[model samples]
Target chain A: MNGNESVAYNLDTEEPGAEELRAGFTALRDRLRQPAGEFVRAKEFLIEKALLVCGMVSILAIALIFVFLFKEGLVALQNASVTDFIYNTSIQYEYDPVADETVAVGESTAYNWQPVGEEPKLSILPLLWGSLSIAFLAAVFSTLIGVAIGIYLSEIARPKIRETVKPALELLVGIPTVVVGFFMLAVIALPLKSFTNWLGLGTIYVDSYNAFIGALGVSLVIIPVIASLVDDALKAVPADLRAASLALGSTRWQMIRRVVLPAGVSGVFAAVVLGFGRALGETMIVLMCAGNAPQMEWNPFLSVRTMTSTIAAEMGAAQQDGIHVQALFLVGALLVTITFTLNVIVEVIVNHYRKKIRL
Target chain B: MSAASRKSLQAVREAVQKGDRAPLWAAIFENIVRGFTIAVVLMLVFILGTIVWEGVPQISWDFLTKAPTDGMREGGIFPAIFGTIFVVLFMILLALPLGIFGAVYMVEYVRNGPMARVIRAAVNNLAGVPSIVFGLFGLGFFILFIGRNLDYYAFGTPRDNAEAQLIEEQLEPLRAQYREEAIAQAKIDELKGKERGDFIRGYVAERMPAQNRKVFGQGAMFWAAATLAILVLPVIIVSTEEALRAVPASMREAAYGLGASKWQVISTVVLPQARSGIMTGAILAVARGAGELAPILFVGVTFFMPSLPLTEPVNFGPLVIQVVNPFQEFMHLNYHIYTMATQHPDPVGTRSIQFGTTLVLIVITFMMNIGAIVLRRRYARS
Candidate 1:
């Protein structure tokens, strides 16, 4: 660099040496193209690997859940059979006057989850019905109101009102599940009892913590889910399609019904399916508000225990390596399978919708 | 508007003149939607209103700062509040790193791979798994499997007591049966009394459970925090991913052109911009953790504790340090509300206090949620 400066100074009126400039430029390129230090490379490699592991942690956690559940449950099979998890055949003892012996009178198949006493019946049927019935009722109720609210928000409400209402819905969405359960038990029961009285239903007692209240609580929890999803579904309809429909002299309601809703039908159905799965898995609300009698009945007034509530109620008290804990694991496994399947179905529907809409 | 409005106006007028009801029918549909919307809004308001109406009057300075008294029928919820804070702090510390890294992995590396898709799907499904199922996983995996293994390897034979109990219970019957047979054999063959005793002891010892116990294997705040870290993993990942995506790609390209590495670009250019979004994820995770009761039902939540879940002072010769212990059971706000409202001996007397506790929990979660929403909105606008 000193020799180059002397050469430039000596040049005076003559042109500077191009070779020196080229050499300087080459030096800069040499510095520019080198790898970002060995230490940096090692650090980057290690960090990337660590992050990749972190990324897969969710998958690992899920696999561990499945593995632990099955492994823990397999031991209990020593005391309880697979058939015992489905239905139990109890030998009914009766006094037969003619035979003068109790003899093998009858064998009746029954579903029970009694994991204590002499006969540990671990049948999941009663819980299945309870989960399904409550979830179904919630689905029906939430879909009715939720879909309407979705349409109103997406199409009818003014922008300011929409902005206000959406956040309010979010606040509702953020309300803890247990709070909703408590409200259903302590508060909602009052209005419901009044309504029951207005209907003059004296013989039909409205139990405070029945499957009905559970359904109501679960539905309230899911309405925001269904509404937001349905809102997204409706919003996915292109603006041009909406404008094109309106230009054809259709009313806003007509356009929504005939154009937007039909176009977003797949997404809407996906939302409802997702909501049903959520309702099926809802725990605290059903646990707190449902009477949790674990009965199989058609009457909405009867108390019922869901798969989730049963786990929450029983798991803590279950002794380590016990049959009761293992039974709960089986229930957990069944729940994971159902929800996982529902999620897959929704993903498929959403992917199909995306592809169709892209075209 | 000029042509479409005039045409619609004429259509309405013509329909009215022809005594047609189709236009009115359309309006009726809109009105019905509005009705349902209003009804839903009213329902939500009624719920919130009921809580505020009953809870606000009961909340006081003592209620906020003091522990429960008279069997939780009187006094404040300070311990529950304290426990919730420490738990949330630990949960965020555990969740944020993995969540942020996972989001980075999805957004940067593996963006086009099947692995990312699988993880995305798994996380979404796991997010929907019942809160109680998380409790099960917490019990079975964290408390039973990992915690037991960690304790056995780190804290000595944690399973010894449980093994002893199981051996005692099972071996008694087996030992009795063996003794009866051994005694009969001894009477026939004239065997020694020591030999018969040895036979009974060996038979009992052989039936002992071989596997895994108590320290971390039981419900404690540590396992509760770990359980909640997994529970809110999905929320953190999704939000962080969204935040990462919000960072424009041009910045990364420019950084790369200047010879900056992938992580360098991310740490310097991306994370700074995505900080608010990551904060949003943390806030949401906190809200979910503090408000969630079912996930912690089996994971260390207790009805009440004489003291907080804090550690005893540790001597380091010159300085002693005492910190909140994550292994001990703690009284949590949500669990406190649960036990008092339903299981407390005198629910009637504790009504006001229950409402007060509910209000405090609600306020904490609501504040967290609002902060997340605000951060998200701000990020979106930027």
Candidate 2:
């Protein structure tokens, strides 16, 4: 009846009586098949809910991950005081002979992460240092090369060159971190070590699996991420800005440096931050190349362990419900917190830039 | 045509010529940028070239078809290759539909709502979550929680953790015995000036019971595939959403004009138009799944899985048992490379094998990526 009313209203201008009568009868017949309509409605409702749930699954997964991580990690943190857990240099837990439990000791606290010793030290500072130094080096190397490539693609390259090079650069993203790790370990590390030795830099020994090599391996993975992001940002800058700068008697390079780069500065920053997040969380490359020696050192040539590598290398053999396992989970929790915050910041910055450009 | 006007015009021409010359620093900077771009391309070439140079020689027909021998120091990586393919296939099966549906909800059903924003943020954060964390999550949730529960419900008790541990403990003596035998055999081979470690190993292995080899309740192909599905879910959802968004509004409007419902319009017009894009996204996700090693490291991947995932026919007769069990441990190319490069007794000896395995993985992943890219290009042109 409702369908008929709407049909009649529409056909009133064309053929009033006969058309309306036929449509009303048809609509009445359709209404008799109300179960089919209900079936369709039910199917649509099912699909909508299924999709909604599917979309929300990621959030659920992340929340569950955080819950599981904290649940496992908090037990260890309870035993290892949060401040000592965070700031103490050594992961060595001194056993109180009288109390029959591991406790912090010594007048001068040491910074080592020996989670599997007589006195298990769970200091995360060294791991943090290793992770930060590698991530910093990787970010610097990747951003320099990535931003350069982006600039070349957006401002300098010919159309044909751009077409060929852009996808080729994207292909870099598909290379697995495992392969990169293998390459570093197998092909690059030895050669690089020998090369560094050949340079005759006295007292500067390059370990085969050092932070520098790890950074290089990680840089390879993050470069494409940064390049593509920066390219997008650079491309988003208005063509009119470049044209105006060029018309004011500036060279092409000057126009790009002054007008385009400034306009896309926020986007470039977001790209760099995202790249840092990527390098920070990367596991396989660091695990294979970063020589899993947790130490509080900034020397690029020395072996250092990152949070990701530590988790990967130790999680398998670590006893379930042991302090070591819990400590690893705590490291994972720290990683998730840091990377999540970085991603959120990057997203906010990127979104704000997009809005500004749109306005 | 006056002399003074001509002189002034000549000076202006000189000035224009001088202006045409870019500043030296700018030229140097431009070249440096260009060089960096070229360096990126060269890096790709070098990586591929090195792998091919070292790997191609080892990839014979026998290498492709044969199983690994001598503790993976010899023979082919057939099991690793097969396991990678199977896991990637399973990952796609689980991730593709869920990802497409999620994208559809984001693009078609939900507009700029708070729920949509939350979902988007979740996906972004998920993408940033370390691959190693995914490994931990897999071990903790999929294996420890879901797997243990499944075992408890199926077998009517918690999986005998003690029994599994007992089996593992039992293997330690056998491994020590084998190692002693290997050392003794190595001395014999050295005295004889020949190689007999393989024969000695085979002889030692013959005395070990099959029951001693069985392991359960921890690393499994099912859990690995599940973890990988979650890992690549963001990739699939992001690409699928982009594809769905690329579908023109006109198509939906046209369907609506024909009195079609929203669901009908999407099922008929929008889905068909975005089919290629969805395919591309699925392929790309498969490519990523194929290459991912971190998530599977703890979930199920092993250094050496002598048998295939599917158990072979027990009796080689007309009536045979063909069981496709997903709970078994499997070898993967990436994990194989890791173990060979790191855990092998002789890392230098296994260099060729490692390179060969890496090359195979690279080839498989590149093929998938190229397939997706080609499909995208064709569809985009249309």
Please report, as a residue range, the 10-residue window in candidate 1 chain A with the lowest summed lDDT: A1-10
Error of 1 at B53 (Å): 1.6
lDDT of 2 by residue, B126-152 (tens): 888899989989988988778776665
Candidate 1: CAPRI quality band = medium
Runs with alpha carbons beyond 4 Å of true place in candidate 2: A1-36, A87-106, A201-204, B1-22, B156-216, B311-323
Candidate 2 DockQ category?
Answer: acceptable
Going through the candidates in order, their DockQ values are 0.59, 0.49
What digit string (tens of lDDT, one per residue) describes model 1 on residues A237-256?
A: 89999999999998787789
Question: Which regions of candidate 1 deviate over 4 angstroms?
Answer: A1-33, A76-78, A97-104, A194-205, B1-19, B155-213, B314-321
- Give me the TM-scores of chain B across the candidates: 0.81, 0.79
**Candidate 2 local accuracy as lDDT?**
0.85
- RMSD over all Cα atoms, model 1: 7.2
